[model samples]
Target: MIRLVLLLLLAAGPALADRPRDPGGSVALRVLEIAALEARGEEKRVAGDCLSACTMYLGLSTACFEPDAVLGFHGPRLAWGLPMTPATFEAVTRTMAAYYPPRIARRFLDDWRHTPRFARVEASRLIARGEARACD
Candidate 1:
């Protein structure tokens, strides 16, 4: 019985891991999560409401998104709504931009990332604008 259960769990693991789920909003954890995904060397689909640190998946080499997926952006700050020092904010922005495609990195730095309010960009629109890739 123990062997059978272990075998079943092993068989189901990859399929389970590949299913997209909402990421709990955490900047450091998101970076670690993306690193793990990249290590797996399989394509990752970004789905559901991707906001906050979830937006960091844009930096992944193997990630794609559905047409209706919500990808939002804002300047990185404390999760508890505390103000970050100007230098810290700039550093965070640069880190996030490193993951984004070049044109997006430019626009995000120049315009939308200055506020806490989410600037939601639909995946379909991003695809249309050549800013993001669509899922197969």
Candidate 2:
């Protein structure tokens, strides 16, 4: 089952860190971390559990202790859930916005804002903050 695959992926790592209280864990963070780990070969067990923890945490539900089960739910959400609630989606978006340049931020936000769940109020605020529209 897909659930089992997710579980194995998450369990492939160690105990995950608490979701950042302020930003919460964002999807982008998970992706970046996964890539970072993969680049480091941490996906392999012999490399230790850091990547596993990162992977597991990335897949976790917003709130839950079970890394495997929690992340199982997150995988699909990652693909389908975009322009989610600013409060909920902020962690990931903010991380990308902060770490990357403004042009990149604008492009990223523009595309993501087009998603169904993107809040108009949030979009307005992001726009006012100089988040350029990719098509602009």
Model 1 — TM-score against the truth? 0.75
| CA error at residue 8 for candidate 1, angstroms | 44
For candidate 2, which ten residues in a row score worst on lDDT?
67-76
Candidate 2 per-residue lDDT over residues 53-87, each given as its tens digit:
13233222221222112111111134454545556
Task: State the lDDT of candidate 1 residue by residue for 1-136, as single tens digits.
Answer: 9999999999999977775657436677788889999999768787767776777778887889898788888778786888789998888788788888787788789986887587788888878987677899
Error of 2 at 98 (Å): 2.5
Model 2, stretches more than 4 Å misplaced?
1-84, 116-136
Q: What is the C-alpha lDDT of each candidate?
A: 0.79, 0.36
Candidate 1's displacement at residue 79, Å, is 2.6
Score every model by TM-score.
0.75, 0.26
